[model samples]
Target chain A: MAQVLSLHAAERRQLAAWACDAYPHEACGLMLGVSEADGVRVLEVRRARNLNVERARDRYDIDPADYLAAEREATARGCELVGVWHTHPDHPARPSPTDLALAWPGWSYVIAAVTAAGMTELRAWRLNGGHQFDEESIEEADPS
Target chain B: MSHIVIRIPTPLRGHTAGADEVPVEARSVGEALARLGELHPGILERVLDGDGQPRQFVNIFLGSGNVRALDGMNTPVRDGDVLAIIPAVAGGGHESGGCKTESPSGTDYRA
Candidate 1:
């Protein structure tokens, strides 16, 4: 039983495009949304710069300032930063070992897999109460 | 007295009274941090070990360069310089419910 994440179809495409644009390197961003009884709903996406220039191939450091600013904006909009999204070039759409260690509970972690051929897949995961990442299902919703 | 801006990372901002960037007057990195700790109690314990040295997981940057590359704790400061206190972002090294925390060896600090 995986958690569900309701995201706008347009935003889903936008994130995949961003991942493609950063081909050969990892791209990351912040997701602002609300948590419902069943899962989470993504209302907005904020792109972030990957400051990990030295190891963009296997690691990403989303500018903390960007995260802080997005959180502030989400607060202003009556929503919360419910998750983070990042790309994994030529890697599987699964949370890596490092991802498991850095992830905090109760937030969705959406991973996009991009390669020279473009984005191959996108998936989401959430840290369970036991601190292990459980696969999440993405529900692309039509814009309201 | 130079007024240096200390940028607080998200994980440690709760100890800063919710301030992201705190400005303080001091002459060096060590002095500025000591002043910051005075202004916001309980922060020093998070970044410093019982020996008063920066913990292994904590990184202090003066401008774009790491303080370790310059002079460690004795790194000089100038007016308008930015001092960033960044916690090492790492995970999966051990099996724990969450990030690790260690209390100052002999201090009664809670953060």
Candidate 2:
């Protein structure tokens, strides 16, 4: 039900670090948080292993095992897996066709456009019916 | 009949009335899912293809065992079993580390 993505400052910083640390390879992760009436509040950003070794530079596949662990962690902390975040090494902070193909409804997606110059942009999105993405606004919020 | 719990992922929670976990009674994975479809209308279409097979982008797990690695839809279920449906989270750029694309693109709206 969340149409927007709100990130705690620390989580945002962590995502940024993940983007840069992965460098030329695409970085993938899970966002754990609570869903609010207006937006999804991201309390934590967990970097998951990208299993797409063959396409490491241009693609990412979050390991299912990591996803299982993330879901358990979220449950233990009384939160939900509200979103997924990834970096497009040198690409724009936008959803690709493959992104749409693998996306699920009711989850926010955050993309960071990273380059040798560092992260240039961070954008949020949600997939709706008809296999399309609707951009969502990102906000910096205080932790609960 | 076994009383099973299906762990609904966030993406499917909308169709599940926002309930993360739902209980059902069934004897096999297929029956459990069929009951879930009846309990949550819009979910089945997303999880299954027209041919009734699991969607390529969706993964179903009976506890820690992936159904695909087991008996799939025919996998037996026991009381207190947990079935989890997780969407495959994936995406990528071009091989050059830049997301070069030539296909007709989907609309990209800015908020």
For candidate 1 chain A, the 10 contiguous residues with the lowest summed lDDT are A97-106
Candidate 2: regions farther than 4 A off: A1-3, A128-131, B95-111
Candidate lDDT values, in order: 0.76, 0.84
TM-score of 2: 0.87
What is candidate 2's TM-score for chain B alone?
0.83
Best by TM-score: 2
Judge candidate 2 at residue A130 and give its lDDT: 63
Worst 10 residues of 2 chain A by lDDT: A96-105
Which ten contiguous residues of candidate 2 chain B have the minimum total lDDT? B102-111
Per-prediction interface RMSD?
8.0, 6.3
| Tens-digit lDDT track of model 2 for B1-111 | 999999988877878888999999999999999999999897898788767778767788998888999999999999999998877788775533334322112233221
- What DockQ do you compute for every candidate structure? 0.12, 0.39
Q: How does each model score on TM-score? A: 0.62, 0.87
CA error at residue B24 for candidate 2, angstroms: 1.1
